[model samples]
Target: MSSSSLQLPVIQNWSCHNCGGCCREHLIEITEEEKRRIDKQGWTAADGIATERPIIQKIGKGRYRLSHQNDGACVFLDDSGLCRIHAKFGEPAKPLACRVYPYAYHPTGEKSLAVSLRFSCPSVVQNLGSAVTDQRIELQKLGNQIVAGKKRDHSAPLIHRNSVHGPQQVNWPDFHRFLKAFDVAFADTSVDFVVRLMRVLSWLELVEQSQFQTIKGDKLNEFLELVTNASVKAQPDNDLPLHRPGRLAKVMFRLLTAQHARHDTEADVRSGLSMRLNLLSAALKYTTGFGTVPVLHGSQSAATAFEDSANTSPEQHRARFAELEGEFNCRTAGIDELFTRYFRVKIQGIHFCGPANFNTTLVEGFHGLALMYPIVLWLARLRAVRNNRSTVSLVDVQTALATADHNFAYSPALGLKSALQRVSLLAKMKQLTSLIGWYSR
Candidate 1:
C-alpha cells in the first residue's frame, strides 16, 4: 500500500525548458470551472491574450478546448515561446493537463497509481531532470487526488487470455509478482530486444494457455523460469529477421507511416498528399522485395533468399547485432526507467492493467490512459523509420511521444480498442527493431 513498495524510480526534479512544443503540439481541454477561472483572469487585446475570439473555444456541444493563435500555437503562448498564463500568474494558473506535461497517471489496482512520462517532450527524451524519486510528495498529492475514493476491482480479470487460478482470488501482491517477472525479463542485458520481447510474448502466451486454477505459487514461479530459459535459448542466430513485408503488410506499413508526415494546416493535408504518396511508394518498393527482387530471382535464388541481407558474414552479423544492442541499450534505458516508475506508481496507487483497461470498474470513469505507452513507442518507431536514421534521436522520440499522446489523450472519437490493436500490430511486426534498422541505414 506504500508508494515506495511499487519500486518506482525516484523523480528528482524537472523544470520545463519552455520549448513551447507541448503548447503547439497539443489541444488542451478544460473543465467548466477552469473556463470560469481563466475568464476571471480578464484578458483584453492589450493584455496580450487574444480577445477577438476568446482563447477558449467550445469543441462541441458542451466540451471546450484552448484555442490556438493564427499560427496554430496555444493562445496563451507568447512570441518568445513562453506561456502567457505562466508568465503572468505562475505555473499553477495553467490547466492540470498543461501543468502535468511528460507525467502521465494510470490506474494500477484498488488503491494505487502508475506514473509514466509523455516522452513527447524533448526534455524527457534527453533524460533531463532530477531522479523522479525526488518529486514524491508532489506526485503523491496528484496520485491521491486521482485515485480518491476509488475501490479495488478485484473481480476484474488479468489481461492475459487465460483465466488465472485461485478461487480465493489474486490480489495486487500476486499481480506484482507477475510484473516483477516481466521487468526482469526486459532487463536481461545479455539478450537482444527481440529476444527479450519474444521471451515476454512467449511467457504471456503460456500465461494465457494455463488455467489460473492450475497455477499455484511455486508453479507460477516455475512457469516463469521455464519461459525465461526458453526465450534465452530461442535467441536468433542473428538479430530477428527483418523480412521484406508481404503485400498487405507493406500497404499497412505505408498507411501507418504516412500518418506521421507533418501537416501544418488543413490545406497542407491535400497539398502534401502527393509528396506523402511518393514517400509511401518509395518505402513500399524497398520493403516489399522490389529492392531485393533481382537477387531473390537470380541464379543463387534459394541461397540468396535465405541469406541475411543485413549482413554478409558471421562477423558482420555479430557486428550489426552489437550495434543494434547498443542502439536498443541507449533507447530503452530511459524508457525502462520511465516504465518501471510508471508501473510502480500505478501499482502503489492501484491504477494499472485492469478495469482501467476496460470499463468494468465503477467510480474511476472511463479514461483510456493505459494505451499511452504503446502508442508513444509506436510513433517514436515511425519517426525513426521516416528519418531513415539508424538510432532514434531523443528529439524525434519526443515528437512521436507528443504526437501520439496528444492524439489519444484528447480525442474522444477514437476508441480504446482501435488504439490497442494498432499497438499490437506494431509490436508483432517488431516495428521498433525495423525502425532502428531503417534509421540506421
Candidate 2:
C-alpha cells in the first residue's frame, strides 16, 4: 500500500504537546523485534533510566513491554517528559507503539488504511496542532511501517451479527455505504446531536433485522435513507421523551462508567494487593450506587493537560452519586460540534466498530459508541457538581472525555462478554436513550 492511498480525518488536528500523559498512563508492549532493538540501544541507569528495574520487563512468556519508573512514567520517558530513546536514537529508533501514540490505523481497502485519533490524548480531545490532513507525509510513513509485512487482503467486519442470524457480512463498497449514511446522519447540524444519535439508534434496529444479501450500492443506500427518514419522523426534533433507567440498568451503567473512569497505571499495578482491593471496593460502591463516589485516579491528568481552571481537587468535594443525576444542561453548540467531530472522525476512519473495535457488528458497536455520549456527559456532570457548579463548562466535558476514552476500546475489561452485554441490555430495555437524556440534562 502506498501513502497516497491513506485516508486521514480532516476534521481532526493533533501534535504531541509533550504532556507525558500517554507515557505515564499506557504500558507500551513491544514486538519481539522491537524488544531486541531496544536491548541493543543499551539503556542503563547512568543514562537516567531507572536502575532498580530492567528497561524492558518480560510481562509474559516471550512477551516484553517497556518498564515504568516508580512514579509510573515509561522507562524511556525523561524528567523533561520526552522519549529518551527518541532523543538518543531518533524517531525511527523508538518502538512502533511509541511512534504511533494517538493514531489508530484501520484497514479500509485492499490498498488503503483509514486513520483515527485516540481521544485519550489531551491534544486529540482539544483538537490541537496541525490538521490531520496536513500530516499526510508523516502519517504515511507510520502507515507504511504498520502495513510493511502484513497481508494486503483484509475482509470487512459483519454489518450485523447475532446469535439468531449469525453474521451479516458486506463487501467493502457496500460497507462504505453504511459508513457514508452514518456520516450523513451525524453531519446534519439541524438536529441536536443527542437527537441525531437517537435517530440512528432507531434505524439501526431496522438494519439489524434486515439482511443485506441482495442490498448493494444504490439499493443499500436507498434502504438506509428510508430507515433514516423513518427515524427522523419518529424523533422529529429535540423534544426528546425522557425515561429514567430502571434500577438494574442504572446499576449496570454505573459499573460500566466506573470501568471507563478507573485508571490502572503501572504505579497502581506495582501497589499489588492493596490496589486490587481498592478497585474491588470502588467496583462495589459503583454497584450499589450509594454514598460518595469513590475517587478515580485518571481524570486529574486530563484536567492538568487541558489546563481546566475549574479543576479543584475531586477529593476535597467528593460527590454523592445522587448528585450526578441532576440536570446539567449538556446540549450546547460547542459540545454538539465537539461530539460531531468526534463521531465523524470515528465513522470516517472506521474506528467505532469492525476490526478496530472488539470485532463487534456495526449495529452493536454503534450502540456502544452512542452510549459514550451519556457516559461522557454523566462524568462531566460529576466534575461540575464537584467543582461547586450547577452547569458544565465545555472544559469539563473535554476533561471528562479525555479521561473516560483512555479505556474506551483499549481496556481488556470493556471487551469482555459482560461489558458488551451491559450495552445490549441497556439498548434492549430502552434505557440507553433515557440515560442519554437524563445525563444530558
Best by TM-score: 2
lDDT of 2 by residue, 1-441 (tens): 444378888789999988988888899999899999988888878899888878888889888998889988898889988889989999899899878879999998788899999888889988999999999999999999898877654788888876676699998899988998899999999989999998888898889888888887899989988999999999899898888888998998999998888778899889999998988999999999999888777654585696654334535577889988878889999999889988999888888787777988888889888889988888888888878888998888988888888888778899999999899889888889888878877
Tell me how far the alpha carbon of residue 281 in candidate 2 is from the true structure, in angstroms, after superposition.
Answer: 0.9
Candidate 2 structure lDDT: 0.86
lDDT of each residue in 155-266, candidate 1, tens digit only = 4335343224422234455555666676676565564443454455545555545554556577767877887777667764326544433445444443333232222332
After superposition, candidate 1 runs with Cα above 4 Å error: 1-7, 10-14, 148-157, 162-170, 216-218, 236-244, 259-441
Model 2 pairs in collision: none
TM-scores vs. true structure, each candidate: 0.66, 0.96
| RMSD over all Cα atoms, model 2 | 1.8
